[model samples]
Target chain A: MPHTVNCQIDHLSVNIQPGATILEAARSIHIQIPTLCYHSDLCVAGNCRLCMVEQVGADRLLPACATPVTEGMEILTNSQKVRHARKVMLELLMSEHRSDCTHCYKNGRCELQNLASEYLVQDGRFIDLVPFKNYTIDDLSPSIIKDDAKCIRCQRCVRTCAEIQAVSALAVAHKGAEMKISTFFDLPMAEVVCTNCGQCVTHCPTGALVEKNYIDAVWQAMDDDARHVVVQTAPAVRIALGEALGLEPGQIVTGKMVAALRRLGFDSVLDTDFSADLTIIEEGHELLQRLREVIRDKNPQVKLPMTTSCSPGWIKFLEHLYPDLLPHLSTAKSPQQMFGALAKTYYARRIGMDAKNMVSVSVMPCTAKKFEAARPEMCASGFRDVDYVLTTRELAMMIRQAGIDFLSLPDDEFDSIMGQSSGAGVIFGATGGVMEAALRTVYEVVTGREVPFDGLNIVPVRGLEQVKEAALTISSPLPEWGFLDGVTLKTCVVHGLAGAREVMKKVADGSCDYHFIEIMACPGGCLGGGGQPMPVSDHVREMRARAIYRDDAGKAIRKSHENPDVVKLYEDFLKEPLGHLSHQLLHTHYVARKRY
Target chain B: MNGLRELVSALAQKHGTRRESLLPILQGIQAHEHYLSDDAMVEVARALDLSTAQVYGTATFYSFLVTRPQGRHVIRLCRTITCVMHGKNQLLKELETLLKVRVGETTADGLFTLLETNCLGQCHQGPAILIDDEPYTRLTPERIRVIVAEYQQKAALESENSGLINS
Candidate 1:
């Protein structure tokens, strides 16, 4: 057993592990020390010295985040000296920070603003206004915006991009107070190899970085007399939107969200889950076709270990980092794009309205969805399939702006036809949900039996693990898929971009011998996207995952092929999966990007 | 690749291509190229198995290493407290007049580049400046003209030698 170290914090003697920091040891005993740069999910940065504490017999105070707990250590977390020093630090931070909080995107959600109010640091009149560099705010990217004037040099976004995502689009270009977060040569994010996963925005403490707001355009579409605005919600939005609107983390408020959208003047409220089911049908057949070519025909041209293309961030990652292997990616568009295409083409045609008159909008937990929708190739409906993309935070702001009491609103149902979805669709919010959903349908279609996992859950692929691998043996394959009979269908799931890097490296070396791979760019998949609620932690992500899985389990229909609306869509409009019409509306291509 | 890039590639080959060799490799590139180019940084990143942004980050953090193209001669004027107290601004003005270029700008002919340094670590020297790693201490206005003429004569000699080789 490891030896426990005894330490005292604010006169309370506690035993903590040796590796624990002063902040962790204090928190272990319920002594809450304030912090700005210390995040529960990221490595200790220690740049923001808000957690300064006085040590007995030591002349200088120590930062609790970078300092480890030792035996017989006596630290005063709330002494006058420590409090004064923290106040001084806050004053210094505010001196350089742009305090236009009322107009800022992170108005009520900013951590620095909260700490300033908590410490009552109104002024540092002793110091004059310091000279600082004036930088231009970069709002060119469709997904995220950067305001250098508001950055406090926390490096949370920098660490998240480099350490977690392995993209490293942002870095510290210069040193000292002149130091600022920038891309290579300070290029705009739109020109960089940014996946726009938004983990940076999720962990940012201030309004320096945030998702591009589309509330105004969405509201303008609602006000347009010539247009009938329809909104679609992603699977992850329902679970996490509650937290932005002051509800608990795990609260499933799908119905309330639809009701609020209706009140905001959207003509119809639909669920992207319906199209998520559609994606499975198209992507599953695509996977099976590739498998036949590779295993049965023994075609060397077809790339094995085909990766899922549901995540736009992962798609962009491949375009920049591994463009040569783009053939290995499935040609299916994401559920958001698939829903947009159908909303304008299939649903609008059935309703006897012009596709141009119907406005298809998306409410997503991802920032990358904005960029994905803006791609010129997403015009399968002869118009821009997705007119506007609103983030989960933007949707909450709309609800609040319309004066709708979100929590107390009556639970409402989505519109019929295009709104119907299966349990497989609802689980698309979590990490391995797509793989599980695909296997649920694929295995049943082949063997005429449920997946061997307990309660239809593919347990091996369903966790917060960075990389998950599983294999399934096709004991009794369908007549058409006899080539796969007796052959083990190996699969893997990679959640974060960092994990995807490792998997891609293995694929390149021909070492990882998996047949199918699912890649989700965000840490906990779509639930931990760059556009989620503030103060996100592992526990927050876990709560979102639990709610997504619960929503899935509660659905009566759990398979994509079993969805009644999807079957009717094939009968009335689509005709068949991956047919001429489906390919035109449901698939897209990617171009290689410069890696600078 | 250009001659400077070839020189950097040779330098990396000489000093084993490893992560720790990044600083020395960057220094070698700057020494030959007078600045670090993006292509050199990318090549170094690939050689060291690191990211290009990370390589650019380290190269930009140091004050001595320039990322943009510099002149044939780099003139650094120390603006430390001691220098400022002892008439450093006058020497800066004199150098600007003699070179016909302001601070942080290169001459039209690309012969001289001027910069303001933090300190020369010779604080007691009062006012000082360094030209291409050579220090000129306790300067006067007359000394500025003499330093410029000396560098100009050396540059002219180098051009004559290159012209002879080309012919």
Candidate 2:
């Protein structure tokens, strides 16, 4: 057993494992020492002195985040000295910070703002000495904006970009007064290797980094009489949108979300899950085609271990970092684009409305979706398929703007044709959902039996593990899939981009073999997206994942191929999974880029 | 690297191309090339198993190390309190008039580039300027003109011989 250190805090003694910081020991006994730079998901950077604690014999107060507890150490967590030190730190941060909280995007949700209010710091004692850095706001990227004035140099965004995403687009440049977070040689964000993932924005504690707002454009479209503002909600948004509207974090709010959209002046409320089902049929068949080429024809040139292309951040990541392996990525567009294409062509014609007159909008649990919608190839119907995309937080703002009582609103149904979805579509919000959805259809179609898991849930593929592996043996495949019989299909799910980097390294060296790999750019898939409600922790993501799986289990139709509307979509417009029309609208090629 | 391939490759071999050797490699390149070129940064990144972005970021963080191709004679005028208090403003104005360039610009003849920096740790020698690592202390406008003339004369002679140092 490891040696333990006993620390006395606020007259309560607790024993903790050696090498534990005072912050960890205090939190174990529920002492609640506050810290600004300390995050559950990052390395301990003791730059912020917010969590100062007085040691009995020490000359000065020590930061609880970085100071490890010694044997029989007596610590004062909330003494006058610690309180005064914390207040001064908060004042200094506030003095340098560009305070326009009332108009800032992160106004009520900022961590520094909350700490200042809690500490009762009326004003700063020192002069605001931080000089005005005249960097042009990088609005060149479609999704996020980086403002230097509001940054406090906490280094959380830099850590998030490097440690989690494996993309060092933001780095701490210079020293002391001139120090700031910057891209390579302080280049404009669009020219750098930023994947437009917005993970850095998600981890930022202040208003320095935020998603590009589209609420005004959505409002303008709603006000225009000729424009029919149609709305679609992503599968992940339903599980997380409630948090933005003051409800609990993990409740499935699909019905209330649809009702709120109707009240907010959208002509028709639709579901992106419907197109997710169509994506399954298309992507699943594409995988089958590759498998047939490799196994049946023994084709060496065919790309194996096909990667999913549903996450736009992951797509762009591959584009910038691993362009030579582009052919290995599935060509299927994300569910958002698939919905946008069919909405303008199939749904508009079915409703007897002009495609140009309809303004299609999507509410996603992602910032990359905004970037995905603005891509040049997305204009399939002679117009931008998705006119504007709003995040889940933005939808909550719209609901508030409309003065709708979201909690009390009646549970309403989505409009018919593009509204129907299956449990497979709902699970797409979680890390392993896409892979499981594909397996559910692919297994049954090939072997003529449902997946052996309880309620068809692939338990191995589900969880918060960075990389998860699973193998399934195909026995007595249906006559058409005779080549796959007795073949043990290897598969894996990579939850975070850092994990994907490791998986990619192994794949490149032929160290690990897998027939399929599912990769999500964000930590816990879309439930932990860059644009989700702030203060996201592992517990919050787990709660949201539970809600997603529960919703899937409760649904009547569990497989994507079983979704009625998607079958009709294939029958009426698409003709087949990878037909000429499907290729025109539902698939895209990636562009290679320099890593620097 | 067409011109610097031999020098950079030689320096990289001496330093053994590790992450810890990045600083020494950058300092060596700056000493030989006057500034870090993007191509040299890429080469260093490849040798050290680091990304080019990281290499560029580190190079830009220091005040002395520059990224852009510098002038033949790089002039660093001290902007610390002791120097600023010692008629540094008069010296700066006189130098700009003498060189026909502002604080960060190179001369039209590619002879000199003026820059402002913090402390040079020579508090007693107030109002100091470093021209190619040689410091001139307590300079007057007349002295500044002579310094400019010396670099300009050398630049003209080097250009005539087709052996200019700026490249």
> Which pairs of residues collide in candidate 2?
none
What would the per-residue lDDT of candidate 1 be over residues B44-160, giving only the tens digit for each residue?
876776677778888999998889999999999999989988789999999999988899999988999999998897678758999988998888889889989999999999999
Name model 2 segments beyond 4 Å from true. A1-3, A129-132, B1-17, B38-53, B77-105, B116-129, B134-157, B160-167
In TM-score terms, candidate 1 sits at 0.97
Cα lDDT computed for each candidate against the true fold: 0.89, 0.88
DockQ of each model vs. true complex: 0.71, 0.49
Clash pairs, model 1 backbone: A198-A530
Residue runs of model 1 more than 4 Å from their true location after superposition? A126-132, B1-8, B84-87, B124-126
lDDT of 1: 0.89
Chain B TM-score, candidates in order? 0.94, 0.89
Best by lDDT: 1
lDDT of 2 at A7: 77
Docking class of 2: medium
